[model samples]
Target: MALRGTNQEFGRPYNRRIVLETIRLEAPIARGDIARQVGLTVQTVSTIIRELELQGFVMGVREAPKGRGLPRTNLTLNPEGGFAIGLHVTPIGVSAALVNLAGKIVGTRHHPMARVSPEATFPVFQALIAEMQALRPKGRMLGIGVAMPGPSDVDSMSFVGPTTLEGWKGVPVRDRLAEAHVLPVFAGAELGAVALGERLYGVGREFRSFYYIYFGVGLGGAAVQDGTVQRGAHGNAGEIGHLPLVPGGDPCPCGNRGCLERYVSRDALDRRLKAVDPNATIETALTDHAGVVDAWIDEAAPVLRSAIATIENLYDPETIVIGGLASDALLERLLAATEPLMHSVAERSGRTTPRLTLSSDGQDAVLRGAAALAISGALSPRFGLLFAGEEERAERDPIMTGPSRKEVAA
Candidate 1:
C-alpha cells in the first residue's frame, strides 16, 4: 500500500507541482489566480514562479491590461522547457514519439514488428530512440517512458503472464533502456499509460476522476481518481480484460472462462467480422462490410455496457472514456448500440460531463500516454522523496542544537 505524508514533509515540493499544474491547465493565468487556485501565498507563488522562469519551465507573457497601476502578468508553460520520449510496444508494432512539456507531440514514428523478444525488440527501441534524439539535445529529454501490455510487474519491470508479451517475462525493460540511453526509464501498463496521456492532454484534463476503457488488440481499463492513476498494489489494478463476464463462453489464456476481452476486444470483433466476410480487414469491415461491423457491434455492446456499469458502480468516476486503436466509426457504432446505458451511480442528476465518452487521442492514446508518464515523473513531486530528504537531513544533523557531547557529559 502507498503511504501518505504530512504537510511538513512535502509542503514545498507539492505546492510547487500544484502551481505548475495550475499554470499548465490554465495557461495565460495570472500569478494571483494561480496562488488562489493552489492555496499558496502570493509571496510563495512568486518565489516558485521565479525559480520556474529561471529554469525555463514557465514564461511570463504580456501583462493583462486593467485599471490597476501595474497590470498582472500572465504565466504559461514553456513548451520547449523539456521533452519526453514515449514508446508503445505491442504484438503488432512499436510506436515512438517525442512530446514537449506542454503535452504536445513534437515527432512520432511507427515501426512494424514481427517478433516480440527482447533481442529483436531492443534494437527497434534503440533505433526509435536515436530518431527521437534528433528532435532535442541529449540533456533536454527528461526520460523515456514505455507502455506495454500488462499484467506488468512494475517493480520487476517485466511483463507477466504466459500470454502477455510472450518471451518478455523477467526482462528488465527499464534498467536495460536506462543503461543504453544513460537516462531514466519509466515503464507503465498500457492502459495506465493511456489514462495518464488522456489526463494530461486529452478530454481527461477536464475530469479529475474517470475510467479509461482502452481497446487495443485486447481490452484493458485504467482508473484515475483525484488526478492519480490507481495503480493497485502490484500495478495491475486495471486489468479488467479478464473479468469473467460470460462464465462458460470462451477460454482465455489467463485461465479465465469467457473473459470480457473475449467478447469486446479488437481481436474478438475481427473474428466476428472475418466469420462474416473472410476477406474483411478493419478498414473493409467498416467500409465494405457494414453488415459485419454491425453484427460485431451487436455482439459486443451488451458486454461493454455491463462492463461500464460495473466500472461505474465500483469506481464512481466522473466519466468513462473509450479509447485505443479502435476506429472512430466502430466506437460510434458501439456507443450508439449500447444505449440506454445500464443504470448506475453515474445516473445521478446534475452531471456536467457525459458518463460515456470517446477518446480524443484515438490510436495514439497509448503512445502519448507513455510520454505523459515520463512527464509526470519528471515534473510531479512524490511524498516518499520528500520524506526521504527529511530523513537524510535528520541523519546529517541529529539534534537541533547543543554543546559538545563530552562537555555535556562532564
Candidate 2:
C-alpha cells in the first residue's frame, strides 16, 4: 500500500536525518560501518559523508593504526555542523535553547514575553540566534523550531491563539524566520510538538495511543494515534483547555464557562492562592498553598480521570503522560492522588482504567517535539527537494559497487 521510492530518491535530504540518527545512536562508526548500519550503500554513504564534510555537518577521524596497512575512516557528527533554535514560547516567558544534533543544549536564553508579539520578539530571537551562531563560526545553520502556545495550523505554520503572542495570529512563522535568517524555519503547537517528540524519542513509543497533558500558564493536550498526532480536520483536534467540565464556573478566553484550564492550570492555582498570599509569585503561590494544590489536584484528578477515561473509551490509548511546567514532583503527587479518582471514574464508567504516568520528557518535551516535527517534515517527500536533487540515483549496481551491504542498509 505504500508508494515506492528508492533510497537514492526518497532519502536524499532524509540521508542527513538518517545518518544523524544512526550516528546519534551508534557513534564513532566507520563510514562503511555506518552505511551498513543505516542500510545505505557504501557509495551513497561516501557521497553523504563527502556532502556532510563539505557542509561541516560531519567529520572523519583517523582510526587507530592496527595490523591493517591503511587506517579506516571513521565518521561522526560535527557538533559545529549547525545548531537548531528551540523556542518554548509561553505567555509568561519564552525559553530558548541552541540544541545540537546530539540533543544537547549548547546554550540557553530566557526572556519575559508579556504583551510581546512575534514581531516584537523578533529582536530577542535575533539576538539569541546570533549568540548561537557566534558559538560555531564554522557551522552554517539548520533552522529554528518554535514550540508556541496553541492553537496552530501545522500545515501553514501559523498561530491561532487565545493567549499573548502578538501579531502571531495568522502570520506564517516559517516564512518570517526563513526571510530573516535565510534558513529553513519550522514552528508548531507546543503540545503537538511534545507529542511528536515523545513518540519519536520519548515514552511515546511505549503506547500506540497516548494523551500528553501540558500544564503551563494554560493547559493543553495532544493525542497521538498510531504513532502519529491526530491534527483533526481543521488541525484543532486537541483543544482540551476549553473542555467545559464545570456547569457554572469562571469564564475562559475561549468564551466558555468552567473550562478545564480555568480549574487546573497554573493560572487557576495562582488565582486560588491569591487569597492566602495576595503578592505571591507563581512559584511562591505554589509553595505557599501546598494543601490547596493538593485539594485542587483532588478535584482535578477526577476531571482528568474522566478525560483520560473518555480518551480510552474513544481511542483506547495505552497511557497518559502529564508534562509542561507542571513539576515532576507535582505530577507524582497528581498521579498518586489521581489513582483513587481514576478508580472512581472506572467504577462509574464500568471500563478498565488506562495507565496514568508522569511525563519523563520534562519541560523540554514540547521543544524537543518541535525539533522532531521539523526533522520529520524535512525528511518527508514534499520537502525532499531541499536536500535531495532530481539527478540523484536510485540505487547502485552490485557489479559496479561490490559488497555494498552498507548501502543496502541505507
Candidate 3:
C-alpha cells in the first residue's frame, strides 16, 4: 500500500451508492435479486445496475442455474468503488494503504518514526495522504483515516493522558489532520477503529457480540454489542492494558504494576528481547529469535486465556478476535500455541471454550477500521452536513451514523 501517487478525487454517483451497498453485503446475487433485497422494483434495480456498470462500481458474470430457471448473472462490487486511505501511526513506523470498497489494497506506504512528535511526524502523514488523495478517482478522496497508538479519547479526538508518543497527549488529531490537509476528519481510539473495521468488514459480520482484542503497541480490547463498539461511560470500556495481570512484575505507563499490557504488548516483548540482545529492533528480533518468540507465546497463553475467560464471563461474546501490529505469521503461531492451552483449561472446567481467532486483515487493522468509521459516517445523507451554511457539525455514532448523537448514545 505505497502512497506515492498524484492527487485525485473520485465521484460516486447516487445510484451507484445503493448498488455498491447491495453488492458489498450480498455479493454473487443477481441484479433482480438485489432489487428485491433492497425493496426497489426490478425495473429500478435494472436502471441502477446499468448506471453502476457504466461507473465501474458493479460487475456481472454469468453463473450456473440454481434450479429450473435460465443461467442468471451474479453481481459483485468492483475492485474500484473509489478508494479510502488507511493508516496506522506507531512509534515504530507508519503503515499506509489505499483500500477500495471491496477491501483490496491498491497502494502502500511505510515510514519508521523511532519516537517522533506529532508535529515532526505530520509530514510523513501528509505525504501519505497526498499520495492517496492523488490515487483516488477524481472526487473520490472521501477522507484520510489515521489510526495511532492509544489510549486515545474518541469523544475528545485526542490521545488520552498516558501514551507511547511524547507530545501526543491531548493533541487534537482530527483538528490537526483536518487543518493540515483540508479534509473531513474523524478520530477516535485505535482499538475502537479496529473493532469497528472488523465489525463491518472482517469477523464481526458473523457474530453480533464479540470482543476485539488489539495487541498493538499496547494491549486494548473493545466490546462490540449489537454491531456497535461499546464506549462505556467515559469511552474507556476496554482498557484491558491497565488490567492487573501480574501484581509485582513491572510498572506500566498508566501507573499500574504488572498490567496486562506490561506482559503482552509489543513494548513488553521489546523489553524481553533487550535482555537477550542489547540493541534489537522489534521486526528483526521477532524474525531472528523464532524459538524465543514461541516461548513468549507459550508464556502469554495463560494470560491471554485468562483475559478471554474474563471477557467471556463478563460479556459472553460469541467469538474473540485477536489482531494488532504483530505480523500475520506471529498471529498464526500464537493461535497454534493457544488452542491446546485453552482446551486443557476447558477440559478441567468441564466447559467448551469459545472460539478464539486471529484477524485475517493486515497489520494495519486499526487504521482500516478508522476508515470504516468515516465511510459509514459519510454515506448517510442526513449526517452529510449539520447545516449547509456552517462547517462545524454534530458528531454521529459510527454504527448508526444517520441518528443524532443523543439517539446513538442512548
Off by over 4 Å in 2: 1-42, 53-82, 153-167, 205-208, 341-354, 379-382, 387-410
**Candidate 3's residue-wise lDDT over 1-42, tens digit each?**
111111111111333344455576678889777666655567
Q: Sorted on lDDT, highest at the top, how do the candidates line up? A: 1, 3, 2
For model 2, residues 1-410, the per-residue Cα lDDT tens digits are 12223365545665655665566546688877777676778788787677556555566788789985999877776654545667777767667776665555667777876666766777787777777666655444456787777666442223323343545666776677778865557877787888887876677767778878788777778889876798777656776777888788777656668778777777777677776778765554357777778777878776666666665566566667788776677767766765654432224354354477777777777766766665555434445444456334322210111112232222
- Judged by TM-score relative to the true structure, which candidate is superior, 1 or 2? 1
Candidate 3: residue 365 lDDT (0-100): 76
lDDT (10s digit) by residue, model 1, range 1-410 = 22222234335555556677677768999988877766667788888787667556778788767786877679998777767899998877789999988788888999977667788999999999999978664326767899988877442223433325777777888988978875567888898899999998999988999999999877889999998899888788887888899868787766668888888888787778778778777855778888877777888899889999999999999999998877888888898888999999999988888889999998889988999888777555452244243544422221111222232223
The lDDT of each candidate is 0.78, 0.65, 0.66
Better of 1 and 3 by lDDT: 1
Number of residue pairs clashing in candidate 3, backbone atoms closer than 3 angstroms, sequence gap of 3 or more or interchain: 17
Sort by TM-score, top down from the best: 1, 3, 2
Query: Could you estimate the TM-score for every candidate?
Result: 0.82, 0.75, 0.76
lDDT of 3: 0.66
Worst 10 residues of 1 by lDDT: 394-403
Candidate 1 global lDDT: 0.78
